[model samples]
Target: MECWVPLFEIFLNSPCPETQASLWLQQSFNQPGPTTISTSSFLSLLTKPTHITITDSSSPSHTKRVMWIQTLPNAVQARVLSFLHYDCRRFCESELCQLAETMLKEGEKLDFWVKRAAHQLLDVVSRSNYEWFSSLNLDSEEEQVENEFRSLPDWLKDDVDETDLMLPWLPISQKQFNLAMQFSSCGENDDPMIEFEEGKREIVEQVIEEVDEVIKEVDEFLNPQVEELVERLKDRLLSLQSTSKAVELAGEIRELCKGGSQSLAILGKIEPWRADDEITSVLVSNLLDGNEDELGWRSHILCSVILPKLLVLKEPASRVLLTATIEYCKIHQRAAEYALLLPLILRTEGINSPICNVLTRIVTESLHQGHVSAFCQKLLSNEDDLKKFICLPCHQSLIGSKLVWTDSLFNLMQNILNHNIHLTQDSIDRLVQHAWESADRFSKSLKFGNFLLCFVTKCAPMLKSQKSLLTEATQHTNTLVTKSVLSKLSTL
Candidate 1:
């Protein structure tokens, strides 16, 4: 079946190729054989450059070839279009116009593949020359074609307008068409007057005023209803005693309070002073004391809703909740679950707060490499937090831990140096020593080498002052790291 693809290509390029050959190929594709042509093989065939040279004489043959492709099964045609980088200039003006119409028709389908192909077709049309529109012959007399043009998306019409072409046949109102023509005429003249036709500007202002009124009416109708719903949910939360049932209800409230303004409004209505002390304790315990084997969803829900509501309470109450949560995480080895709340903690309490000291201690003591990696990623992603984290006293334990050679640790180190964050001498010494010890692990050699290159480049002055350590790194087991170190040494 794969052998037939090359023969089909030869037939397409053949001078005066008979239509009968295409019909024969279609029949061969349909016939049962020992090996069936797979989608991948068909994709390879479509991607090959068509060697057919275009000329006035060969235009009809080109159209025939395109039409032959259209005769393929809709599934095959859709797949080819989705993956193929179609060059629109290969098709003649008439065929290109027809292809656009076909793409518009296919765009209406609900199939994933068909929709993808239609999107690809629209991209191709957007990148091509505007001469194809001239071939459309979209005049008032051709009402069917005019209506089809009108049905095209407004974005595509805007794209055409950007070309500044005098396309009077475009499907717009007579007044708009006349206005556009006047603008074009004024642009071409040396000293031309630019003015809207009488009453047109007033009509535009009236439409704008009507639209604004509709928007205000819609907002007035929705805000009070949303506020009322939030108020009821808050009241129900205060009355609930079962932790599981309360969490279930909180999920619905979370959905309504997604945006910042909405969330603050919802939080403002919830009188945390009225929330029962026993209920808050039960929710926090359920969040922090879940089984290690349980999925992370329950913790995520509680941290997102219950934790934020608790933090909204006045000073002593909020500080007590923060202290209790951090202490529970340390004693129960719940660092992985607790990491989920870091973003909220950072936003509310900030990086300099005592909770950050607990975070550093957890990283030093955590058993799983995966959890530490996630925690580091969350910290490194925030520039201000990362700056403070690098300077923490226990940061050396993070750099010199047994899991020091992992990708996340290397990224954390690289980001610290990349930002020119001031790391104490002890931290830098520990990082270099750990790199040397881990360089012989063949699996991580490439990653180790990349980190060393970044380290040497960013900390060149510090490395030069410690010549013995720098010299030892050049003779390391990993050749990539050795080369990088030697390159830096020569420049010194």
Candidate 2:
């Protein structure tokens, strides 16, 4: 079966006229012996000595290879394809080189061929003096291995059944090995490995640098063909095709092209979409409207670029663009960017977005942080439209959380009142609720210290007109503050 399959493949791969090859293949299939389909038959099938043309002009040779490949038995077709790929790649200028690439690409999809060809190619790359990896034009040895593995047929990818496509070379931890060895006498006592000084920080930096170098190399390799590929990938992400898969594939291709300096040079020319721009704005908007998992990944991607830009874009247009992004983050419940966006949002007006509510909640909840109270106090010092919007809601929200109100709220309230901006209705409602609650619970029962007394003392001027409400609040104020309050009022 194997021998006959290869014979049939030779018929398909040959450039003999289709009519003649088909007629010959019919005869060859009817015969039982492998020798019936001879080399002479293959030689006779070629219409052109070196040039194989097909009816389609756009893909004359590719069309021919596809039509021919269909006639071979699956396994034999794969073997023929392996040899063809080896040859065409070996001699890039051969007339069959284009045909060979198409054949192997298609062959990679067939089940029987994928594993076999992958193993064969992996072995060749691992053991042989393959010039592809040997070229100094390739930047890093690790990168060369990565690309060679990637350029393998898709079925031969690292995670596929053909994972032996690259040797499993991940560094194993010594502690894990020692733990295993402690349990059994027969355990393989591999040498206890030492830490390589390669922590995540160093690895991440190296990967980033490698990626940058690869991008630069891709830019120089860019031709019309490669540009079309980049455009296709970009379009796939833009056109609502699966972005995670596409981005993943794009990342691989980006690394793959790094094999040659020319390829890497071409890649660097390919720009990722800029932050807060129309392209990314549309992307973020669509992504936020997707499912939660999709939104999460998209948020991460956007954060990489947008978070950085939020800190640097001084242009009004960019600021407006950032406002939209903050709103998106808020709607998505992403807390990662709040620290960066909070300061920027604190300065923008005409932007009463729903995100502000989320940000308000974050600020209110973050009082437990050592510096949050201090930071909020500082932000409240300079009164502006931006500060007013942030402060009013934040102060109102903070009153509801015991953690923040304990100390942070008092300090923040004093700061806001000192700015002379009348607290909004929301602020008044929360303050009234808090004061009423405090009076009912604490004002009379406990002795208040001077610090607590100082708060009421400073606020006497503002509360003088609302004595009726204050009298009710004083009833429940902490007992310590209650006496201090009474004493302070007597002095007033």
Q: Pick the candidate with the highest TM-score.
A: 1
RMSD of each: 21.2, 30.2
Q: Mind giving the per-residue lDDT tens digits that candidate 2 earns over 309-406?
A: 44333334444455555555444332232223343343332112233333344333322222233334333333232122111122122212112223
Q: What tens-digit string does per-residue lDDT give for candidate 1 at 1-492?
A: 356665455444543122223334456668786655543454334443334433576455443233334555566555444323232333343443445455456444435655555554554454434355656665764665445544545656674444322232221233444454444443344344434433344433433353233223222323787878867877787778786775565556556644323343344455333455545554445433223211123233334334444334333344444444544443333323332333333333232223333334333333123334433343433233231211111112222212313544455455444332334454566667766655566334554566676777655556656656655654665555567566776655
Q: Lowest-lDDT window of 10 residues in candidate 2?
A: 163-172
Clashing pairs in 1: none
Error at 131, model 2, angstroms: 71
- Candidate 2's C-alpha runs over 4 A off are 1-233, 243-339, 364-368, 381-492
For candidate 1, the per-residue lDDT at 440 reads 60
Query: In model 2, how large is the Cα lDDT of residue 150?
Result: 34
- The whole-model lDDT of each prediction reads 0.44, 0.39
Most accurate candidate by lDDT:
1
How many residue pairs clash per model?
0, 39
Error of 2 at 415 (Å): 16
Q: Model 2 residue 474 lDDT?
A: 63
